[model samples]
Target chain A: MSRALDRTGIWIGWAFFADLANALALTFGYMFSRPVTMQYPDKEKWLPYSRYRGHHFLKRDDEGEIKCVACELCARICPCYCIEVIPYEDEKGNRHPAKFEIDMARCLFCGLCEDACPADAIALGQQYEFSSFSSRDLVIGRDDLLGKPGKAATGGGVVSARLNTEQDVLVETSEPQGYNWWRNIRRT
Target chain B: MELVVALGLIVFKVALLIAILLLLPLPLTWLERKVAGHMQQRMGPMRVGWHGLLQPVADGIKLLTKEDHIPAEADRFLFKLAPILALAPPFVVFVAVPFGESVSVLGTEITLYVSNMNVALLFVFAVIGIEVYGVIFGGWAANSKYAVLGSLRTCAQMISYEIPMGFAVIGVVMLAQSMSLLEIVRAQADVWNIVYQPVGFFVFFVAGLAESQRIPFDLAEAEGDLGAGFHTEYSGIRFAFFMVSEYAIMLLTSVLAVILFFGGWNGVLVPLPPLLWFVLKVAFFVYVFIWFRFTFPRYRYDQLMAIGWKVLLPLSMANIIITGVAFL
Candidate 1:
């Protein structure tokens, strides 16, 4: 009897019992519960932190002059070699890079160029929107790199004493985390 | 008027069940990802709407907008047909499942299921057994040699594992003495099947995992060997259907496991309702399946077959014989 019962039990569970349990459970459990789904697109989300890493631009002095002194340090330290500088002599005989370019497409945003700059003129801004249809649009030039200093430009050749401070230099050109493309893609 | 009301209720219940089953797969997909992430010391999908809850929706939208691809030499008809076949069985099997007991609706005693079948157990098995056709067709229709071999391997593995799967349930039927799922659940009210047939329960669980083609036994879709396995050639909504169906089957198997051995909504007399118990049980099994999927690596194809044929089959047989002796 025990042997028969065991055989019957195994047979029943395999062939019958399992399905029976499911059938009963599902049959009785069919109360329609509302699905929990949050509709998106109509809802805008707040990001956890600021995430943009476009190109870095330096602040100029009050004399409407370029802060970069044609020192090949930024170009030399750049890992991607995306930055290009062309030095020229102005009528005043001051030697400065006539053309400075930082290719946003190739930049890794390692911040090495900023760290390498002895003059403390260049910095990575928070502006992340750097989208462009072509490569040329992403190539930031010297004029673009030389962001607006915190104060409006006064008379020429003033050599204002306020330009000596680090914070003053940053305030002059900083524009609320200027354009950065690297930070946008890397933000999880 | 009564007849019209009854027909309307049936249609409503059928639609309701299908909607629930179809939508449940989406959450299960998210849960699987999150659970896998936690196990691997990573936060899974925390960015999308609140703990990555909306990740599946984002995924759905992304796939829909992406380009659809089809192989040049593939059987377009069969390739298209495969995901449909894969997705349909689990939905069909849900028809006979009882979530709660018969309740009076509109003065008519209506069953909750889409259809009531006397041989519901065999029907579920047969339907689940036919799941192989989806994988085989997916692999074969892709027109790649890897696809063919993967499908063949899936067939063999499925067949091997199903032997033990069938054997495990035989024990339950022996105790319940009825093929009607409702009756089996009622039979287990006093004594749960798991207490009486522990060995059979283990066999069934293992077999269930293999049947669902989950991890360890997931060689059929092993990316290294088969390049996305059987559905490699499929893209766009076709791929989405394949994914949705895979998760649906997992839910089906987990639900089946709960009902078969875990008492199926009969554990405690709670004030809430019987359906709550049923849902909780199914949820536990669902999480367990996800846990197992994320914890283990895929088993080798040969080892997978050997485990099914040599290990599970023999153990299942012994379980039956031993239980038979004990009852005698």
Candidate 2:
């Protein structure tokens, strides 16, 4: 009798209960709560206390000069090796990089490259909506690679520890990805 | 003046629920894409709205503008009729769902529901059962073996699950002593059906999932094997209607579960209002469904059937017996 019960009884019990419970819980418990979506550019997303990580861009100087000295530190430090920089001499014998490229596709946003940069040239900025039609479009040139100086980063890879509060930095340190799987999992 | 105001409030409440439910599926589709994208370590739907919130809207417009294609060999009437028939039945079900209790509207009493039939529960079940006809017709009209087979599988799965679902709901009816959903909810003022009949809750939940044709039970549109399943030939706004119906059913099932198991907005202390608590509970289950969709792989057709038959049906029958004995 127990065996029969276990086979048929258990299955039927779960079928009925789980279905009703799931439905009830969603409708009564959470569905009617204010939907978490905010109208973007018009309304700000209350993104759980400084967890918003925007697009990855390198930092620029106050005078709008590219901070990335083409030090090749970002390239060397990148795990995916998506970053490529060519340090060349100009006609005036200026030892600046002739070609600088950062492939956004392969970037892990690990921020190690920013950390490795000696000149404080590379910084991942806020502006996470980096979308493109082709792989070629996603690859950032030297001019596009840099972040704005002294700007409040909405949150993403390689944010300045100074701009963020201690707790925010601590959280960021704990979760290097900034937006882990859990935070992004919005329950509909 | 009082009657007009009361009627207006009822209309407003029903409209609000319908509007919210209708808009929900679009975001669900977007979220599915984003979740799938992140899971695969690739960004999905980056362009349209911020993080693709507007992606569904774009898709809606795009689908609407697309050409409606019907094969020459297909039965023209049913081909045109299939998606609509498939779509309309589920959409019609919200008429009976009680979203909240009556409140004073312009000094006139009003109910939060559109319909208050004594047989509301039966009406919902009967309507849902008829939804299969939509699928069958669509499949038969398509003139493709794949579509026919897909529809047949869907019919079998939906019909098989409905048994356990119906039985599970019976347990709640026994306790509430009424088939009327509002009365059932009102019956659980002190104790929820869930506290006494957990087994019934489980059976109903699984059956509901299958009924919604969600993941783990979504053999209806098994893309890899069925190539969009029964609606393979459907296009344009017609296809959109089918999609809308699917999400609507999902929302409806969620609402039903809340009503039956979770005390249906009956709490010890009504601090923040019962309605608020009700919505929170419903959202939790919706998230779980989303979570399941994200986390689990689709079940094979045979395995799904075996589980429904060998497992859910019998278990629900026993649960009814258990509930009966416990009450006695």
After superposing candidate 2 on the true structure, give the runs of residues whose Cα lies further than 4 Å from its correct spot. Answer: A1-188, B1-18, B35-43, B268-270
Instruction: Say which candidate scores most in lDDT.
Output: 2
lDDT for each candidate structure:
0.74, 0.75
Compose the digit string of candidate 1's lDDT tens values, residues A54-139.
34666676797877777889899999999898989889888788888889988898888888888766766544445578988889
Interface RMSD of 1: 12.3
The digit string of per-residue lDDT tens for model 1 on B24-81 reads 8779888887766655444567667888899999998988887888788988888888
Name the 10 consecutive residues with the lowest summed lDDT in model 1 chain B. Answer: B35-44
Q: How well does each candidate superpose onto the true structure, as a TM-score?
A: 0.73, 0.64
